[model samples]
Target chain A: MIENKTNKPQRDGFWEKLSKLNRRYIYMSVGICVIVPLLIRMRLPIFITPPTKSLYNVVDKIPPEDPENMLIISFDYDPSVMPELQPMGVALLKHCFAKKIRVACMSLTVMGIGLAEMATEKAKEEFPDVKYGEDYLIFAWVPGWSIVILKMGENIKETFMADYAGKSLDEFPIVDKIHNYEQVPALVCLTGSSTYLSWITYANTRYNETICTGITGVIAPEIYPWLQSGQISGMLGGIKGAAEYEILLKKNKLSKVEGTASVAMDPQSITHLLIMLFIVLANISYFVIRRKK
Target chain B: MSTNIWVWIAALLTLSVYSFLYKDNPIYRFAEYLFIGTSVGYSIGFLYWNAFIPRIVRPVQAGDYIVLIPTFIGLLFFARFTRKWTWLVRYPIAISLGIGAGISIPLTIQAGIFRQLQATMVGDFTISNIIMVVGVICTLFYFFFSLEQKGVVGGVAKTGIWYIMIAFGAIFGYTVMARIALFVSRVQFLLHDWLGIIK
Candidate 1:
């Protein structure tokens, strides 16, 4: 019989006091830790992961001034996840525009269309050289999830009759040179849910399109197997992925690049260290109290 | 964009949501209700313009009568609320389920199972790859519930439990990062966007 060893420390006076301590105090400290780093513009050392670098390489390798090497960036998140995900979407568009990679943009989710527009607004403002309809096109969210995915391989224009603003696809100069998943080199989805999985299942399998995903931290681990399988070109797992990309772009001397993700990193590192500190202190207190008992 | 009232509204709404961390108050409840109401309102409007208008109306305006097939099938969904017509709802539900299951099965097998197995089998001989290969096999062995645990198989299965625990620990660490990120973002908003403390 397998003996399951349980090592739970006895809760005594010390544990009770720590537990009863004002919750507001904890919240206040967390707030201070995040804010102090931001005000000073504190820079944190970022170790870019292999996956993040692979994503960077894939984006960097998109041949400049070539409309045929088209990229599709789909925004599939909402305001709730805007802070973590919006930076990723904005940074990716910045990279594409900076490299002059002709791209098409869409959203799988209804909530995502507004967020997609926000990302574009930020990116386009920073890089004024990027013109609408010629350089990039924005598509509206359509119902029928897999139906739309399947339609992309056939007639992408027919999939959605017009842009998000109700302008026909023919009006877009970018679509003149690029149509369907076949013409596109890479399809990137910055999503908060399993929307990336659908892209992998449909787009990658059927049309043999090279896909890259930028997902939230929660779903990032599940995507590792796919990354290892080489079904995905690259992955940006959460804002860490975004921060890594920002560091790479900054290293390349891309001026006026938004460092939002990198800025978030200082707070991220500090907060993580703070959390570990709390856990260690708690454990130490627990063990010391148990010994006294 | 100087002194945008909408920004102030957003900041207030954000604070109201954060207020729940303190205690449930009328302010939090009001904001929560308002958020849900606004989201539903916006989604309805967006679906009308983006999906309903473009996909259905435009195709009909262009004399594509074949599009009515899917439209009629969709209307069957509304029949669910009526007592007499409740039976009619099952047709759409059945159709959707049938279609969804049909689409998902082959793709799930190809991407989720077959490719996963293939990747594990043909991985290059690296430290990480070797660990992954062993971990995968052991983990698979742990799920063999039919046979009683005995000798080497039992030991391998036991090792699989450790790998599973380690994987879970990694996921938990990532989950911590994600939660911290959410809190940090709200603070970022309050500091950088609202107060303009950080530039």
Candidate 2:
């Protein structure tokens, strides 16, 4: 046959084969690598960075006031980034509710309303007594991004007349008492976009509200200088950031707080290591081919 | 392993999208189309329910005079569909751009430039602080393209390149982590929520 006559493995065939590897095989390997580690529990050492610790300290040390008006945690990202940012919402809610700190949760982005609702609902399951519109409230999404934040500094109820479910703010005795950013002690903005800038511009600078941010990993480094300068009070960079927060709570001998962020870290760490190994292998093959040529 | 129909749908759609890692085919195209269609449809429904219903519909019903101005301006967006009245859309666009520009200039100068410059000056006197100060100066000089590369400027510009490359590498590394985090999230959903293989 023509294959038998012409086809023979060359002396340098190994590197050439590696260099010409099909993309599908690599994809499959990564998929398998992620799924296998995910099927079991692996406790990865999550180093708690100072920025993340600062956020925890801020959230933790907030005075548990009567009627529980302490923080406004803004859920500003949709489901597309729920994987990275939602964990922070869940952890923050658990931390607040457990400490008996009242929070008024809202979202600036329309798509983030569902995520905000989901995170709040999930956290409340742990502590059944944390009633909606009492200990915690979901304001949901308003139309204006920067305008909403600006108007919120003036009057929150005027900006959002009601909560997510068409209920009058008048009915909720807890939320009715809360108005404007001046009343708010701390604000945590979790976002997948540039909505954080609006919060900083209007909410922080104008009203002088204490603001922390939990942003996606891609935007983390860009905002690092902000954290160092104390422009923002605290920060959670990504899922790993969320995991670090979860760890901080668990270490304090608090209630069970292990959730998606901690569970997902194992696969994340393994996949990252696998990627590095592949990069090395790829470069080796590239160099081998170039030197031979 | 999962009884929920929603989980099954999510799993299948995720697989279809991941199929793009191989050569593009009908499955990937279907997934892509589905995602776009779903996003647009969801946005319309969400904005209406969460925004327009409460902010406009309820307010105008109660005879709030202030609500009418924004409502009229919003209607200008639909003018793009009409040939003769397309130019009318410019009024709303101009108002928005003017407002946005007016707001952005001061805020950007305050937060983006002023606060950053303020941060650089007032850091603790450490080795990292020294590096940061040097890095910022060199990086700023590197962007000065008006002046040709001469001896001292060239040396400073070269140092600036190094800082710029390091920052870019940090960004690239974070970008990789972001992408991997996204993909891994989908896989986690498949395993934990969809398949119920792990909890």
For model 1, the superposed segments whose C-alpha errors exceed 4 Å read: A1-16, A285-293
Look at candidate 1 and give me any clashing residue pairs: none
RMSD of 2: 3.2
lDDT of 1 by residue, A57-149 (tens): 887887876866688898888787777788888888888888888877888888988888888888888788899887777886888888788
Chain A TM-scores of all predicted models: 0.91, 0.92
Q: How much does candidate 2 score in TM-score?
A: 0.94
Candidate 2 error regions (>4 Å):
A1-12
Candidate 1: docking tier: medium
The DockQ-based CAPRI class assigned to model 2 is: medium
